[model samples]
Target: MPSEGEPHILAEIAERHARIGREQLALLRAIGRLDPEAPWVREGARDLPHLLAMRLGVSEWKARRWVAAARRLPELPGVAEALASGALSLDKVVELTRFATPRDEAGLIRWARHVSVWAIRRRGDLLERAPVREDRRAQRDRRAEWWFLQEERRFGLLAHLPAAEGAALAAAIERWAERVPAVPDEDGELPDLAARRADALVAMAQASLAAEDRADRPTVVVHTRLEPSGGPTPGAELERGPVLHPETARRLSCDARVQVVLEDGHGNALRVSPVRRFPPEWMLRQLRYRDRGCVFPGCGTTAFTVAHHLRHWSRGGPTELDNLALLCSFHHRLVHEDGWRLRRDGDVFAWLRPDGRPYRPGPPPPAPAGPPRPAPADRPRPALAAAAQARCAPGPAP
Candidate 1:
């Protein structure tokens, strides 16, 4: 057994190790924010974490986090130096980094040595909640208006709207929110009127844009049902509508049309059609359901994704359900035009490297909670099971 002195020495060493670890992390974070063109700085930033993780054989995520924390060091040079000299704890440096402004960050570090972490957090929150002056607020509003006009110039009318119209729309939305009943204090949760108004405004804008586009375009509704037939049963329900883009309408007119219907809560049809020619819509929907967002694993790019066919479309592969997958534009090109492979297995999808092994991806999110359980499993046993047993038994009282 170790003596008391031995245990004390071990504790001291462990504390020292933790202190060193924190300083190293702060340093790496500082480097990450540095200009990449600065060669010496770049070399240190790049090489340090790689070396640390390589030596420890830790996961890349942990290494990156450590480096990110380190990169904030330049914002708090005194804290960084103290950390390097083993004069301050790592926790203090982390608290200081939250204030990115150099002066504020330095002030935070100096204050941290004398105050509790809770006090620091409270002060930070208070600073964040401080109100802006009227002049500053007006300046900000003007700047936002100017930026909105600039966006209009860059992207044209589709992406831009006049400031007055936008403000009127916003006010109308707020009026709509004011009509919703406020929750009582007992309810413990109340609707955020501001957020509700914003959401309503966004939804209205999207619907308005979609309606406008549909009015100017030709649309053909195609009906689809799963039949006893081996493949999907597709039937056309054509109508004389506005003009559609030739390429888009042509895909619908094709013999190998992939028809699917998506509906709203009221059973009103949302989209009906011949799917995208490249990767069929059925496959894209399946990918969307399975992946929920971008299929790049850790990537959070949830914007529109392109359906990519693993096999080339020109090849013998039909644009059917099995041949399609959803990938963001970046990953789509990476798999098709560039050199990468994607494989699907049941509900799961995987990306593969050129070497033919699975390219490791992040784990899927946890499934949602299921419906409530019944009181007894056998209480409502199927009548069919009892009937079958009776038939198997010898003829009874007869």
Candidate 2:
């Protein structure tokens, strides 16, 4: 019933698909063999997953799966063989590695070939270990701590919860996060789910404070020198918190209820001024209308954004519409606290990174070609015996 060349064409297609599988296996093995201290660190990648994401043009989630599969391939010869032979796919192998032991990999390969990738993943989920029975030790281990990093001017929360309570808390945060409007990330993509959860937690805290009826909400008192005889007063100090960078102080002062206090070198207040908002209201409304959302490329968040002064008002910068730019909280922090710099050139704004390079999204250009590399083998073997020998190598008897 088939045409004469149809079978040949189909056979060639099959051959190439199998060849691709073998190539993927070889790539995974090489990734596995990479030294922990690879050159990716120097390029600003935090770890292997980040490096893979940047260099290979893949998502961090996908890179993590590749790294995980590569690490286990050295122990699963049968699984590697099936992948190389195209009996199983890269997705199937990645899922299998989640729970497949070397001894059981042969059986899994047989089962995987007859089923869909989803089926294999479902089976992997089922095979993963479940929570242990809660006991006194588990209850005693539960803890939550709030810590601050002075140098980074960052705060962190760490918690260890019992499985039941942790699940409940996670579900609550997830539900609340759904109510929080989604925002675009640095790359202009929808924000990471983890970030939404963090925002949800902050929203919960804000809601708790809003319930209390008072003459005025609690205020954060920042001690700053109005007169900068030097280049700039080093920074402002929070009443009970760590010292804030000058840029951070300027950002807070932009739309805040600011009460300026002229203090002497002896720490006595010389004059106290009435509290007032910077830029007033009409100018802020016009600035918001002109910029709508964050002016940072790709970030279009309209909520929780502030008007940033192109030049600090403290240094004789004008409080005019031309001197303002709308920025989201994250990007504002980047411009102020982080070493990123932003300036307007005519109607266009230029963003510069810590190293003074133009800030641009997307991965860097690929490195130049080097010497031709060796091709991968069709059938690779695990060095089980060699590993065992090295672990039990003979030494002087103790």
lDDT of each: 0.48, 0.70
Best by lDDT: 2
lDDT of 2 by residue, 78-105 (tens): 9998878878877788888888997888
List residue ranges in candidate 1 displaced over 4 A.
Answer: 1-69, 72-77, 81-106, 111-283, 345-398
Which 10 consecutive residues of model 2 have the lowest summed lDDT? 389-398
Cα lDDT of model 1 by residue, 253-336, tens digit: 332334445444444566664543444446656766655554654442335465555554434556665666656544554554
Consecutive 10-residue window with the lowest summed lDDT within model 1 = 389-398
Q: In candidate 2, residue 69 scores what lDDT? A: 87
Backbone clashes, each candidate: 17, 0
Candidate 2 local accuracy as lDDT? 0.70
Candidate 2 similarity to native, TM-score: 0.51
Supply candidate 2's per-residue lDDT for 248: 73
